[model samples]
Target: MKKNFKLLMLAVFVAAASCSFTTKSFEDPDKDKLLIDLITYVLEKGHYDAKQFDDSFSEAVYKDFINNVDPIKRYFLASDIAEFEQYKTSIDDQLLAKELDFFNLVYSRLDQRIKEAQTYYPEILDKPFDFSVSEEINVDYENLPYASNKKELKDRWRKQLKYTTLSTYYDNIEDNLFKIENEEDYTPKTKAQLEADARETTLNSFNDNYSFVNDLERNDYFAVFLNSVVTQFDPHTNYFAPPDRDRFDLQMSGRLEGIGARLQKQSDYIKVVEVISGGPAWRGEHIEVGDVILKVRQEDETDPTSIVGMRVDDAVKLIKGPKGTQVTLTIKRVDGTIEEETITRDVVEIGETYAKSAIIEKEDRKFGLINLPAFYFTMQDYEERNAAADVKKEILELKQQGMEGLVLDLRNNGGGSLRTAVDIAGLFIKEGPVVQVASNGKRKEVLSDRDSEIVWDGPLVILVNDASASASEILAAAMQDYKRAVIIGSKQTYGKGTVQNLLDLNQWLRNNDMGDMGALKLTTQKYYRVNGGSTQLEGVKSDVVMPGRYAYLDIGEKEYDNPLPYDKITPANYSPYDGYIDYESTIKRSNERMAKSAELKLIEENAKWIKQRQDENVVSLNLEAYTQAIKDREQYAKRFDVLEDYQSGLNFKSLPKELGLIEIDSTLGQNRQRWHKNLRSDIYVEEAVSVLEDLKLNNIRQGSLAKIKD
Candidate 1:
């Protein structure tokens, strides 16, 4: 998935960079302009599909940049937009000349508008909102025009704030009334007090947004602007600031020294979104999802620094540190109780991010189920522990435990390493092409599994969903092409065929001192199935299609504005797997069951309901109407809850190695237990297991199959 700076690409830049960029003495020492020149040069020479920097490209950058800065039409009035419209089609010309006129103007105007809006919020929150007023704030902001003037902007702020406060006000009233009715000696707060509390919450949220925005430096906004330009080529192509690049590396590595709780800034508080399994937070058993982190303190600190209204990035920097350190966090529990917990930071392996196996015991049959979250690998060392290596180990271990069939769960697996994906495919098939990679004006490179060792020559089923992308698609497509595995789950996987190479921009400069120049995740190649079909816009379709929530969602590569088009090249010279006796019949059997299942019917209904709800964007502002709507939704949604409670009657157990680890690591046990419980309720997994049972191997041994060597 990652490549070193291409030698030819480097050669193209080195001479010019060394001559023009080596000298620190310049007429204008503007790093932004320098970065623009460097990035544009790289894109021109190195990108897989370099787009023209013409009027159309300029117009896209203009619209995207404006949206990226002020998405909700809250800031930058009509006059400001009108003033900036002149450069809409001239941005390409400016970039070619390395001129920052348009960028500088917009940045200055946005800064001034942000300052002005900061003043507007506190003034607006000072007054109480009347919930009786039947007024609706249309949240369809993309279609809505910018405010005509200051008066209109102020009214927009007021209506938006009122809309936000309404929900909290209703909740406050409900909670108070419930307590008054249930508790014998409970005294309810006045309606005015409830209203005041709701206003305070809204005020805190507004302040938080401003505080986070205020923390942004010119470089941060510049990164956004750079992305707005680069992403014009494709959605995956992005400009990562230094901090952002570091974060991306951490996510890919799946190992971090921290409390290991994923935090997001919600209102004024840092809320725990997920407690990584086997990490300190999960082991501690105190911090949980929905718990708000109020303050963070290092081991040697005298006073805890209040993290309220702090940026999530800054808060994370405080919370995470080197291994064997201690950080105490003041947590506001979901139940509204306050508690302080001190946790020792360790080298936490995010267990969820790696390949984990569960043994499915069905009527004296032991089936292997390995859930791979990503095709992760060590960026520096491919030989180090990686997803493919881990999965092979899991497969071997499962075989040791009397495993007859396997189900590779790749649901919600936004892919990582490409090499690992090919390696994983090699596990299923003998020496053959896994995926074909093609750069613009270059011959297709057939990345094949050279190793003739078939790890698991058994009935295999792969479960994928809309979130399963890139490497996930490659592996699934390869297996599906070879008829080595029966792919199940969503109608199609996430169509993201492009391969990106994370290029360090600093590497392009010689003897330069502009600080960290950050990195660019550039799309260098497009990958295709071994069948020569690209999964660019059209993702790999499942063998036995199952209903999913994302079946109706616009989250695929095709929905993206400027995605690479789908095409086919000459198919790789590889023969299909002759291992399965009745692959088509097995698929047909699964489809027949899928059509009749009550659980699947309910799931489809739920997905439709979700799409219906997603379409209903217009919301009422009146308290009575809003509360009634909420109640109605809740009452209607009660039927869908049966889908969650539906049991597949399948027993899921851990392998022998994990069983021993579970005795010592209770957190691991708890994580597995929760996963198994969810799997039991999963109709998709149940179908996959059923398909695995139905699939009968032909046993036409590996070396015997006729292969067309290229």
Candidate 2:
């Protein structure tokens, strides 16, 4: 009886995985089965919490994989989903057997759907939309069901396109009205002509989008399938395709071994998209964005090789190499002038990848504001270019300029290196245990600062928001735990404590048979705060909760799918710093002040309204109704204009040493000026400054009431 049941299940799976809904046959399966087997072995061995590949896991993958492919319900009807559900439980069995039948069937069906769906958009756009109709479209895709039939699917596409066109239509009208309001002589385009333009723009965008989608190879589909499978284990653990790996490294580290300029394949020549901040190209100051690379030459060669029509991957091979190497490129500038630009390859530090400081002066007190965008550090060279060392340098410079208090701005700092976090924490207090890491089977390793001497023991205030993550959470949590720094921002920091190690797939292979299987960024361990709690889901609780936009939104590490469960271990041995004794009373007084401030109350209300508006997806297609909606929103938006307009009354300036770089790099100078301008108008910075004043260590007797008046 059991054997018959097993055979019956296998039969159902075979039938479900075979139906393609297309006449065109998929490419013959080659290394896909092998790839799946290899990935399974790695995930089983490497992932911190490998789940049993049972019926439950398979069902989760079946649902998530489909959503990842067709999120908007534009593809795959209810009939298709019904057919595919037959193998939903047996997908785990197939995966164990290293089968591609399930993936192949879905991939083929999606391709067929895409081919058919691409036709509907152009057809819909060819006709003019009647926006005067009293109808609305529901864009709540999560709640939406797949269309029952072909005609219904076409109608869905029509409504979606019409809504997109309406945005362009309204923007055009607003531009013309603005011109009229400013008394500029202008003739507005007729409604018919305006409709045509909007349709054309929508059509062009659809075509471009479909073109890119169609260009994706089978490997791309495999990547999606692989991630769908792995991310089921944990959000942080997954595979990286070659291009994705490059982008991840660049974005996270902001430094690559390549020529420090973003490149795009533009027809024939590889165009420089944009120069990286503080990169080799930026330092060379010879090549700029919009330059066309025609020829490339290596260090040993006298003659340059033309990469005129080479693939971007192949061209990049000729360009990127080891540090201290030289690569020369003949390029056409935007003005059509041709020149040879030689650049010495070096580790290009992305401007935001490190710590930057500004001396903010208010009421005869100079407070240091360290805007650490990300806690970046290169493992290859631990001592060089880490966030900790750079922040220490910034602090020393600010102190030279008579900085009294410090505001460590961790807002939007999606964190990096863990070692740097410990080191940075050391700089603020007399060092002890900073963080604890626990591997799969190993004992918890308590990371501590051996350094006894403090760098900046002055009154410290850490400014964090929901976007502040990982290493940022560590530093904030440490300081908050030690009662060393006053934490102030949105109620908490972004909770992400898991540590990931990027393992090269080639390292796992005994012999090189399947050429680069890409890399696996597997979550190997979870780190805990020194005070025993893990920031896995529960982020660092702020001392003083302030009003901001992200407060009401589900935007944190906890919001991610399949996150690791938060747990606690025995607390690491650490001591509280007696540097700032008035922190507790200062926080109490601030909360009292915040309770009385109408501005902060108004800000919280505005945050709730924004979240409510974001949750509303259904929109009217009628032009008059749409315009009225926009006007009503604008009327409400006018009330919150005072939120941004609040002046900090803080004077910010770059240190004398950095001002020279500002002179040499005009981009750096312009960015500095812009940042200073924003700081001058920032309400949060003003509030932070007020907090800093209250935190002035042993000198709290001079302060009676907060300077932020009623």
Candidate 3:
């Protein structure tokens, strides 16, 4: 099944084989123009459902590029938009002609506007906001119009800045009051002082944003323009710059050669958000979340470059290097102590990206729950470590620990390797056609598990949500089609039927002097279920629908712009699993139980409340009205607070093997403890386990638990 995914890639390679791209000299020396030419060529030659470069396409690119540059209409004026509208229907022609006139004009104009806009925020925050004035700001930015003139634009910035500073101002007052009562010899600040502090904080944030914006190079904006052009083909299709491609590779492999500390830019400092377990940062205990990285110095360099006010990307470049290299970081600890720490970079594996399992005990029965965060795998070696293999190992371990049933949690799993999805699906059924993939003008290929061995044939439950997509959908749809598992969670999974192949653009060049050309994630094919249904826009429907936070929200692939149309192909020859006595009855029982579940009803109510809050975007600028509105919402929200405290009463613990590992690695132990605790309180997991309990095995699959216990 894994090899078949490679064959699909082979087909993509073959489709573009005729192009015979090489490092041939181009008359156009501009890299941006060259990229446009190369990208458009690949799109036309390789995209599964390629679009024509017509006036309509040009119009789409124009609109999307403008939106990409200034989404909130805060930068560009009405006159600027009117000027941009002239080339709205000419972008497609420019793409084909390898011209960057439109992109150049917009980029230069945006640069000028941003520099001018910088003067406005600091001036606006200079004077204290009149919070007593009865005013409101509609934050539906998409529908909002550009400012008609400079005065209107500044006014727009005023309302937005006031709205932003208002919350902080109120918080300052509340915090000061609390400190006055609680702390000994507390210095109390007046409302005016608090307002000034709030304005300063807002001003600092603006400065940080402008600092980042200023750090952006022309190549960065070109990447945005490239993506705006490529994504017009489909949402999944994208152009990744060199750095972004590296990140994509790291994400797919879940391994990177670095110190393994996830950093975020806050105000001016690059703050450590998470120190990945088993990495140098975690091992040395020199860095922790909330520590601010002040400077980075390589072992080869005598001087340390101060990272204050630098973009996080640039700071990261300074920190990350070849494995075995050393980098010293000047850190300001959470406790306010400044120190220098040197760390040797190494290949850090992100444990969270892999499959993790927990055994749940309910009324003396054991059930296996494997949470597959993503269908991760090594890019170079498929057998090294992967989601499917790890899951199989976990299942076997759970079986050793007397697991009678299994719950494969695909919630928030945005999908990864297609091969792993096929292999994972094979673990349940003996052998069958798992999914059917189709490319343009090619025969449909059915990716099946050729192996006849059934790893776990007992009762099964698949937990999913709107975030479960691509490979996740493939697995869930396969199991559902086979009637081998009861699908639980959201009303439907994330509808991402299309498959993307990451093509390194540098491969097309030979004897090339140009630096890394980055990569293109092109949508190459669309996959369908064995039952012939496409999960494109209509993702896999849950056997037992449950209310979720996204229930009332427009989410998933259906919400994406320019998504591929949903269509079905001829069904693959397959038979449903006969292990279930009555699969329909099992689903019905779960549905009835869910219908009566008070916890689920409460969750549904909370979801509706969240949706209502999201819909109410207009906010009052008056401090008193805003504070009252927040208090009123919080007062109404108190009923939903019990949802967080709800416990399934199920006992979740790591298997014996993991328990041993946990004993040595306290971080892993803590993470597992937190996960198990969350599982215990998770209403969805509780319901999934309940469904597992209801799923009975036929005699053919009976005594499997007994065999496992043996």
Query: Cα miss at 101, model 2 (Å)?
Result: 0.8
Using TM-score as the yardstick, the better of models 1 and 3 is: 3
**Each prediction's whole-model lDDT (CA):** 0.84, 0.80, 0.84
The local distance difference test score of model 3 is 0.84
Model 2 per-residue lDDT tens digits across residues 1-710: 00111111112122222221211124435556767877889889988888899999999888878877776678788888988898799888988998877888888888888788878988889999998999898877767899999899999888888888998998878876787788656776788888899889878666644544554556677777888888888888877866566656766665778668878765556889989867788767878889999999999999999988665555777888778999998999999999998888887666756678899988877899999998887655777567888899999999899988899999999888888899999997666999999998367899998886577768888999989999899999999999888888888778898988887777766876655667788988999988899998899888888868757877887777889999999998887876566778999987788788778888899989988887877789899999999999999999988877877678999999988888878888988999999989876777788888998475452232122111
Worst 10 residues of 1 by lDDT: 1-10
RMSD of 2: 7.8
Tens-place lDDT digits, model 1, residues 1-710: 11112121112112112111111222233687889999999999999999999999999999988877776777889999999999999999999999988888898998898788888878988988888978887766667799999999989888777877888899899999999999989888999999999999878766655555665656566677888899998889998877678767777878778998888776667999988877888877869899999999999998999989776777888899988999999989999999999999997787777899999988888898999998888776778768999999999999998999999999989999999999999988878899999988478899999988788888999999998999999999999999999999888888999999999999988978677778899999999898889998789899998969657756678777788888899899999988888899999999999999887888888888877776665778899999999999999999988987888888999888888888987778888999999999888888888888898877555335333211
Model 2 poorest 10 in a row by lDDT: 1-10
- How far does residue 437 in candidate 1 sit from its true spot (Å)? 0.7
Give the best candidate by TM-score. 3
Report clashes for each candidate as comma-separated counts.
Answer: 0, 0, 0
For model 3, residues 280-366, the per-residue Cα lDDT tens digits are 778878798999999999999999999998767778888988899999999999899999999999889998888889989999899
User: Each candidate's TM vs. the true structure?
Assistant: 0.87, 0.89, 0.92
Candidate 3 residue pairs in clash (backbone atoms < 3 Å): none
